[model samples]
Target: MSSTANISTRTPDQLGASRAKAADNSTGKTPGPHRSKHRRLWWTTLAVGVVAVIVNVPWFNALIVSFKSDGDISRGALALGHPTTDHYANSLGAAGYDFPRFFLNSGMIALGAVALVLLIAVPSTYAAIRLGFGGRFIMNASSALRLLPAIFFAVPYFLLMSNLGLLDTVPGLILANTFLNLPLAIILLGAGFRDVPIELEEAAQVDGASTYRILYSVLLPILAPTLVAVSVLVFIFSWNDYLFALVLSSSNATPITLGAANFVTSTGIRWGDISAATVLSTLPPVLFAVFAQRFLVSGLSAGAVKG
Candidate 1:
């Protein structure tokens, strides 16, 4: 009788709240780790999205303006109300700009630079890392060189090229780009070389494999992805280089980077034409990156994990 009186004294709301609490306890599904992890993931995604937006907004705007006409652009609105290909046409050839020639020149020089960089960097990195042939000093020196401004070597390089009669030539640009790209290539290749195990070479040697043979058969295969990554990177760097091209190249060796400057004249800045050229210039590297991103990601990942 006393228990019945006590239960009757409680309100319906109180009884319902008590029953819900009992149900929750029975399930044993509390929100601590799961909820916090989800919250962190959400914040991380939001941050990445914001950063991407901020970085790409200018490029996106440029892309939109590239498709608009000169008259439309003059109106000062960012809309592509009347899209036209005149800018692209002008960039390609309609306005006396031999962009295709510039493209070919840049491609040749970039490829040449990549070839030269790999030729020297690969063997030197192997010797330094595997043979301990002054690896530390080489790495330190390369890092120091990378830190210095490119302009520091401008005059010296210019005089050297002039003496060699290499100024305003394709070979001149190739050598210049090679010098510019070498240090970073060495650093990157060194990292990749370090990721490779010495035991593989030793094992090959036990089977009477020469050092060259072992490097060719064993190490090169493992380093293939890294090589591709380095090649793509060096290609892009060589392709986009403007300062050296400006100082070294003339009509015979002029790259698209230098070619794009033609759009700027006393008549005024050709915003539409320049933007179109910029878009064209950006395509090769973008395509290379997209195609080789798998190798690049894997190579960098491998280098990051030393063991």
Candidate 2:
């Protein structure tokens, strides 16, 4: 029969190898290489889990302290023996605290900054990457700005804001955060732009699409995930900014970062109140990340491979 002839045509070495493989499979023995690979994977997972727990211990303690009473916190015990909502109530409803206003200010400023950064960074990065307009200059300037500490610009920004009557105002904080976040947005978007294929633009142009049309209609859709990632990062950075908030705003424009300082009085640091405020301040960014996590992971991994 044809099957018998095909089997007899196999080389001796191939037959021996196939029989050995079958024997190993029948005996339920894994190949050495596969077993070693699984072992390495297991060890790697365990190591990462250990490291994650170590890093999160302080944050876990802070969460516990947020729900503890003042006396319980002062006792230096992480246990929530008598869990209470008094800290949350004080942080939210206390007259001098005004955390709701702080939350509002932070949201407004962070959103405004994100809007400005994406508005400017998107077009400019496209121009630099595709059109070769100020490519080196944009890259170098942004890189240099990244190298310099933000405090370096604090004096000039304060003076400029004061002269423009923008001090202690939401607009002033928005502008400051926009400036701080611009370089990072540009760098991130630049990478995404570079990863895009130029042939797509050429084809779009052949179809009578203008440069703006190609960028908006073609490239923008492709870069949507990266854009969302950049927006989230800029929003978080703007939300958590403290130095500019400390120096530039006093009362009217204070974000949560500055507002949290209200818990630190001349008497002493209110650990319970501070922890509660800290927990409250982190909610927006955490929720933002959770919602955008899908796009965030994809966008960050965009350039990892090539088709």
Candidate 3:
């Protein structure tokens, strides 16, 4: 009996040890998945950070160089021993290109284009998405239009503008920008409008709302974020467009882009002044991007899934 009892006690001890070992094994194994997940997250973060730095480095370098003198910039030197505001001062001063005039012209044209694009695109997109009138053909045509290079239409556009006596004016640039940006605006806003629940519109209509009233009160509010995104995109496109401005605009209606291009003379290129102006010129887009980044991301993601 004593021998059996001793065996039983030893067995229990052995079983307890086995259970403890198992518990330890399970506990230790749990960290493996966590470790792997952490590793993956770290790698993804590192990759994104690296990419961001790579993309932003050129702009950062240009900004730093903008404050430096012409000689300092030419040497490709990192540290500016004699940094000065001369470049900015010169850029803004009478001696440099008329930055103020150019800025104003570009702003007005971009704002006008964005406004018109939104006005036309929102209604068209609504009709396309809600009414479904030749939706596939419309989308396909817009995509195909993008495939054709902008320069292809430049000659035709120039001739048309000249014939209409609309050449070298803000109105001409505004119209050109609108046409160029309209397709993209329609694509984006159409996708946004489509994502709106049909039930909501139906409910609005059931409440004795007219089509225009339903759109204005119900749809526009939901599409506000997307509208902001499209506006920023259109503004950037219009602001940076050199080719259209070059071809369409003359001395009286010259935009900042054309003015910047003209900075390079036959004799020499003014690197400091050019870089300063470029940096300054980039501010509006940058500011808009920074402010609208969240909306932009949301709009793009939502549009992509629906579109």
lDDT of 1 by residue, 167-272 (tens): 9999999999999888877787887777777787888999999877877888888888678877887798899998998888878899998887754653688888
Model 1: CA > 4 A from native:
1-47, 132-135, 294-307
TM-score for every candidate vs. truth?
Answer: 0.79, 0.79, 0.80
Candidate with the larger TM-score of 2 and 3: 3
Total clashes for model 2 = 0
Candidate 3, residue 101: Cα displacement in angstroms equals 1.6
Local distance difference test, candidate 1:
0.80
Model 3 superposed RMSD (Cα) = 14.0
- Give, for candidate 3, the lowest lDDT window spanning 10 residues: 1-10
Candidate 3 Cα deviation (angstroms), residue 306: 7.2
Q: What is the C-alpha RMSD of each candidate to the true structure, in Å?
A: 14.0, 10.5, 14.0
Worst 10 residues of 1 by lDDT: 1-10
lDDT of each: 0.80, 0.80, 0.79
Give candidate 3's TM-score.
Answer: 0.80
